[model samples]
Target: MSVWLPTAPCTPRTCAGHTGPVRGRLPATALLLAGCSLVLAGVVCVPVVMLLGRAPRDRLIRWWAYGVVRAFGVRVRVTGRPQSPEGAAHTGTLVVANHVSWLDIPLVAAVLPGRMLAKSEIRRWPVVGPLAALGGTLFVERDRLRALPTTVRDIAGALRGGSRVVVFPEGSTWCGRGPGGRFRPAVFQAAIDTEAEVRPVRIAYRTARTDGQAAGAAAFVGDDPLAASLWRVVTAAGLTAEIGVLPPIPAGTLPGRRALARAAQTAVASDSANRSAESVHH
Candidate 1:
């Protein structure tokens, strides 16, 4: 089992349901504002990408994510920054982060310059998909195994093209949940085949309630309304998020994809557990 500790205000806290209307309304209103921005970004920013070209598209989408963070009333704190491969300014790099929330996308974007490879379903999400596409995001359909080789090739090409690509090894958000969640290992294929240095990131939401307590207390996974949960989170007071980038997990003697994924997962899970334990002691 792995434990998690978040060191920011965004960590989840479920105040008694009776905890005043003001607290509840804040997260809701903030989410509404952010959602509206996504709608606008999808409609306006995505089309602008075609006119402005890929570079501008990437920049604008990042700006859009920054706006979403602001609207959500969440501030981000980063520790243990990732190192881009030597000469990577002109090459592709792979960024791997442990999944935590829907906010993970914007959080990663805000911290590092990279386009993300997300599940194909995300692209179909109302308002979100278009904006993500504008950001040069690649969507993968996990169920379509036949298409995986192509996907891996695409990722390799992106890295070779000098674009930094982000991947979530957990394959889904573990928002407010403790660590040690099984890692899928599928995404590791791209890094291995491409010989890309995998940058690993650990994310934890720190809230006034408790360190990483938001994972279980906050609503994520299992048919919970994403928008609603987001709203609840933003309005809740004193929420902050922090992301820590571990050293790049280079292609080591670790023989295969499973080994690589495990290495990365272990690094992440250990960090999460340590943080959680430290929180308890504090």
Candidate 2:
């Protein structure tokens, strides 16, 4: 990943996945205003989401998510329709999207207000931890093998309750240097039990450059601290996220959980590979 200073001179360069010129800094006042907006969003909106019931809470959170994306000046272009049930009630809709950055949460949440499943460790994080918990996020202890069934049960129960669930089957995030990492199959069991539709989603970050996409800067990978990752996001220029919500595959159509996982993985991975190739030619 290439790190660029906000104040750096603008010039195209080829190094460490960066293919275009770094952007010049925003004016001090503009940056300050942006910062202030983010702070206010967190302070005012977070509490509001907590006080409201699930239906209204998710709506406010989703709208606030859109605001946060704009406040950071990140442009998002979504392709493909999200597979949703006609009218209202759905037996269960499982949204499975590729994970690149922490931003993936709000980007997707802005569209689907479903309960998201994240790793257990995130429960200890700063403000985000509590907000996520209150927003109905399901956390799984990925390291413990024995915990898998219980987690799957939790997801299945949520689905049986008529709530949509979003998950990153990749388990961990990666720097988008190639096709993204593979999806773990265990989570698919929840879909099988409830016979839910698995919706495969692909989010590609496109920067205005000929070399690489902006995901290189925003990816939360390796030993990079959360603060440093946040810095890279604020400083990077011409960042845009392209989210593709592919058609959903019904679990009843698949033979079993493993097959469901493979099918979803193939769809998500193929979309990611095509995006990687497209980024190179630009």
Top lDDT model: 2
> What's the distance in Å from true for residue 138, model 1?
1.4
Give the per-residue lDDT digits (tens) of candidate 2, residues 1-282. Answer: 111101111111221243334544664235436755775666456656677777787777667766666566567666666547577446777888877777788788777768889878888988878877876789887767778888899999998887889988776666554666667777788988998788888776767663444457657765557665655566666777667777788888988887998899889877443442221111
Candidate 1 differs from the real structure by a C-alpha RMSD in angstroms, to one decimal, of: 6.8
Off by over 4 Å in 2: 1-19, 25-47, 50-56, 83-89, 211-215, 271-282
Every model's TM-score: 0.76, 0.80
Q: Give the 10-residue window scoring lowest on summed lDDT in candidate 2.
A: 1-10
lDDT of 1 at 152: 76
Report the number of clashing residue pairs per model. 23, 1
Scored against the true structure, residue 41 in model 1 reaches a CA lDDT of 59
Instruction: Write model 1 residue lDDT over 1-282, tens digit each, in one string.
Output: 111111222223332121322355645675667666774655665555657765766677667676666567666666664556465434466887777677777777766758788778888998778777876788777767776677778888887777788887665555545553566666677777767777777777666556445434233444456665666566655656667777777754478888988888887766543342211101
